[model samples]
Target: MNRRERRATAARQSGRTSPAALCQAGFAHLRSGRIAEAELCCQRALTLDEQHSDALHLLGVLCFHAQQPDAAVEWIGRAVQQAPKAEYLLSLATVLERQDRLEDAWQHYSRALSLKPDDAGLWNHIGDLLWQLGRMDEAARHLQQALKLNPHYWEAAHNCGMLLLELGRHAEAVECFDIAERLNRASAALHQMRAVCLSALNRFDEAEADYERSIALDPSLAETHNNLGLLHWRFGRLEQAFACFDRALALRPDFHAVLNNKAVVLLHLQMLDEAFAALHRSLAAAPDDAQTLFYLATLQLLTGDFERGWAAREARWRLPSVGLVDRGFSQPLWRGDRPLEGKTILLHSDEGLGDAIQFARYVPMVAALGARVILEVEPPIQQLLGGIEGVEQYIGRSSTPAFDLHCPLGTLPLAFATRLDTIPLAQGYIPAPPATRVKTWQDRLGPRDRFRVGLVWAGNPDHKNDHNRSMPLRTLAPLLDCDVQFVSLQKGVRDQDRAFLADHHDIVDLTQHLTDFSETAALISCLDLVISVDTSVAHLAGALRAPIWTLVPFNPDWRWLLERDDSPWYRSMRLFRQTTRGDWASVVDEVRVALEGQLSARRSRLVEPSPTPSAAPVPAAATA
Candidate 1:
C-alpha cells in the first residue's frame, strides 16, 4: 500500500472515532447525574456530526433533568425527527408535560404507548397527566392497568389512591394505600394517604399513628406535621398541637398554613402577643391571604383592641362567605350618627348562640333611638331576648322581615357608638322568666343556711380558645375547699371531667337536674355569687342581676373591654383575668382569696339588721 492510501484510511477512522467517543462520554455523564457536563459532551458530539441521533437524545434528557423543558423539547423533537424511537418519544412527551402543553404531551405519550404498551411506568405517567386534566375515570383505568402489568408499581397505586380520596371513595383509597405500603413500606406518601383516609373515617387514633409513621419516614414532610397539629387541636391538646405546628415551620419557614395554625394555637393558649407576632409573620410570608387577615382581625377584636378589631371585623364583609341580601332596606348601617326616628331596623344574630346572648344588651339601645327594632335571634335566646324593652317584634324564627336597616348582633358596637363607659349597666337585661318558674327554682333549693354559690368550670368544647378559657373540674379543687355550698352550673361535662367529679362527691351536681338556660337563670337568682369561666352561664348570671365572677383568659373577648376589673356591659360581673398565658393557678388562688373575704363578710352581715326586701334585688358591686 502507498503512503497516500494509508493517510486516507487514518482520516476516515479518526472521523468515526470522534463522534462515537463524544456520544459515549455524554451517556456516561448523563447516568452519573452530571447534567451540565453531559450537555457539553452531547453538544460537542452534535458539532462533530450534526445528524448524530444518540447525541441529540442524550442532550434532550440532560435538558429535561436540568429543568430546561423548552430546550429539551427542541432537542428531543430533532432526535425523534432523526429516529422515532420509543425512548425519544417518551422523553419528548415528559418535556411537553413539564411545559404544560398537555395535548401535545398526550399525543406523544399515546404514540410511545403504541410502540411499547407493556411499559408500566409509562402507563403510570399517562395516568398522572390524565388526572391533572380532570379525566379521573380514564386516569383510574390507566393506573389500574399499570398495577395489573406490574403489581409492585407503588407510584401507580399511590396515584390511584389519591384519585379515589378526591372522589370521596375513602375505603377504596385506603385499600390502594395499603397495597402501595405493602410494596414500599418506606414510602412516606403511602402512609400519609392512609392517614388521610383513616381521618375521614373518624378513626383519629389510627390516623394520628399513621401520620407519625409518615413523619418518621420523611422528616421534611411539612404537610404531615400540619395535619397532625390540626388533629391535636381538634382533640383540645393545644400544647401538642403547637409543637407540631412549630415542627412544620422548622421544616419550611415560609409554610403559611403551618404559620396560621401556630398562631391559632397561640390564640387558644391566650398568648396574645405571641399569637399576633405569628400572624404578622404569616402575613409577611404570604401577604393578601384573606384567611389570615380575617383571623388577625378576630383576635384583635377578642383582645379588646376595639379600633383594630373593628377594622379586622370589616374584612369579613369583603369575604365571599359573607352575604348581604337585598331586603329592600335602604338605610346605611347606623354608625350612631343619623337619627333613627320611625325607621325600622333589623338586629340579626351572627356567629354563634353565645355571641348573640352576649351582644343582645344593645338591642334596647337601638330601640331607644325611636326606631322600631326587630330583633332576629337564635331559637335558644328567642324567649329570653323578647323581654328586652323597646324591641317591637321578636323576629327570631324566620329571615323574611323587610327592614330599613340591618346589622349583625356583634357589630352593634360599631353602629350604636358604644363607648367603654356608656355600655348599658342596667343589670337583669334578660329577666328570670315568670314568677312561677323563679318560685319553682326557689322551692328546689329548699332551705340553705350557707352562702349559695353557682359554679361553671367549662364552656363550649368547640370554642376556638376553649383550651385556655375552660378549666378542668379538677382545677376547681380550691373552690371545693371553700365554706360556701357549691352548686354545679357546668353543662356538657366531658368524660375526663366526669371521672374527676366522681372522686369529689361532696360538691352538689345540679347539672343533671338543670334542663335549659331558663333553669340556669332562675338558679342564678337564688345564688349569692356565681363563679364561672368565660361562658354562656357567666353571661346569663350577669343578665339576671346575680353577683358573678368570671375567670378570663389572658387575651379575653372584646366584650370584656380592656384593662378593667369590672365589665361595662354588666356592672354585676367582676372580671378575674389570667396574668400569664395558660396560667390558671394564679387566677384560681385570687378567686379563693375573694371568696374567703365574701364568706367573712357574710358572717358579719348576719349579726346586723336584715337587708331591705324589694321586688328588684340589690345590684352586685365589684370590690376590685
Candidate 2:
C-alpha cells in the first residue's frame, strides 16, 4: 500500500504543476527573445491544458512576430473570448493594425484602454491611431497623457512632436522634440523633424546644421534631403539646391513634392527644359496638385506659350496669394467665347501696377469691338488711366458699377489669343501734355539748361524679382553726375537710397511732392527723356510715347522677351539688357553712351542757324 500510494500522489502533483510551469518558462523565453524556445514551451503548456490563456496569448504573439497575423488574430481572439484581459485585448488590436484593419483595431484599442486607463503603452497606441485618423487635438491629448503616465516614453514624445509639426505649430514641435531627446533617442527622424520646425521659424543656420546631422545619421531619408534643398533654394543658392534635390529624387523617384521643388530650382537657374521635365514628373505623380498646375501655367507664360499657359493658369485663383485677393464676381467670365458687341464689360485692374498700365492699351481695342467698357483700377492709377480711349467710365477699387460681363485685366490677353505679334500699343494713350504742369515743374526745377531726364533706380521691393530688376542707387550715381538735370521719379523710395540721394544734392528728389502717378506723369511730360529700371514708371513713360530707356535683367520678365532691343508691348520703350546675371554695369554704360549722343545732337541743333525761310513771300515783295 505504501509504494503504490506514494507513486500515485507524486504523479497527481506532477500533472497539476506541469501547465503552470510550462507557461512561466514560455514567457521567460519570450522576454529573452528566444522565439523557438518560447514556442516549444507554449505548445507544451497548451498540450497539457488546451485552454491555458497565458499559453494561447504567448502563441498568438509568436505568430504575429513571425509574420503570420491571420494565425495571430485567430489565436488571440480565442484567448480574449475565453478570459477578458487588457493584455490579450491589446495584443489582438496590434495584430489587427498590422493586418491593415484599422477600424477593428481601433475598437479593440478602445476596449483595452477602458480596462487599463493608466497604461502608458496603451495611451501611446491610442494616440497613434488618432493621429492617423487626423484627429490632431485628440491625438495630442492622448500622447500627452501617455507622457504624463511615463515621462521616459520616447515614442509618445516623438509622435506628439510629429503631430505638432503637421499642425504648423513649429515652436511647440521644437520644444516637444527637445523633451524627447532626454530619452537618449538619437535617430535621424528626431533630428530631421527638429530641422523642419527650425526652418519654418526661419532659423536657417540651425536648420541647416540639423539637416546635415540627419543626413549623416541616415542618408536614405529623401524628405530630409528635399527640405535642405528648399533651404538652399530660398537663399538663391540654386546650384546647392539642385544637388540636394537630385539626391532626394534618386533616393525616392516618386516623391512628388521633391520633384516639384527641383523644378523650382531649375526654373531659377533658367534651365527651362529641365525645369519643365521635372514639373511633368511631379504632375504625373500627383495629377491633381493645384500648386503644380499653377506653377506649370506660370512657366508656360514665361516661355510665351500663352494658349496652353492660360488654360492651365486658370488654376491661379486656387493659389494662396491669388486667393487672398478680392476675386468675387457674380457675373460669368467672358473668355472671348461670348460676343461683347453690345455688352458692358467690366475690365478690372489685376496683378501689379506695371501690368495695369501695360494692359490698359487693350481697353480701346475691346471698346472698338462695339462694347462699352468700364475700368476698375487702383486709386493711384485712376487719373492716369482716365484718358484711355474706349473706357466709358473709370472706377476706383471702392466702386463696383453694373456690368453685363466681367474679366480680369490679365485674362484679356488670353481671351484675345494674343501672341507676340498681336501685341498692340496705342502710343500716347495715357497722354500728359507738356504744358499741363510746365509751371509747376519749371518752378521746382529753377530753369535748367541741361537735358531734363527723369530717373527711377528701383521698383516695388515686395516684387519677387525686385533684386534682379531694380538696380542700386549707387550703380546709377555715374549717370546722375552727367550734364543733365536728374529728377527722381520714384514715389516710394528704398530706405538704403536716402543716404545716397542726400550725398548727391544735384539729383532732384521730387518724390516728396509727387502725390500720385498722375502728378508723376505730368512731371515726366516736362522732361527731355526718362531713364528707369523695370518698373511701373517705365510702362507709364512707354504709354505716354515719351523717349524712354529701360534697364532689363538677364532673365527678363516674359513681356521684355529674350534678346530684344525693343519691346512690342510698349512702342516707345528701348531695352538695355544685362549680359550677365545681376550685372547692371553694362546697362548703365549703354545708357550713358546713348545719353551723350542725345546731348551732342541737342548741342548741334542749338548751335546751327535756322534754315533761311524757303524763298517765301519774295514774289509779293518784288512786285511792290
Which portions of model 1 show Cα errors greater than 4 Å?
A: 1-176, 183-190, 193-254, 265-275, 284-287, 314-341, 397-399, 417-428, 496-513, 554-564, 578-586, 608-624
- Candidate 2 yields a Cα-based lDDT of 0.84
Q: Which stretches of candidate 2 lie over 4 Å from their true place?
A: 1-202, 234-238, 321-326, 426-428, 433-439, 612-624
Shift in Å, residue 163, candidate 2:
8.5
Please give each candidate's TM-score: 0.63, 0.70
Clashing pairs in 1: none
CA lDDT, candidate 1, residue 223? 93
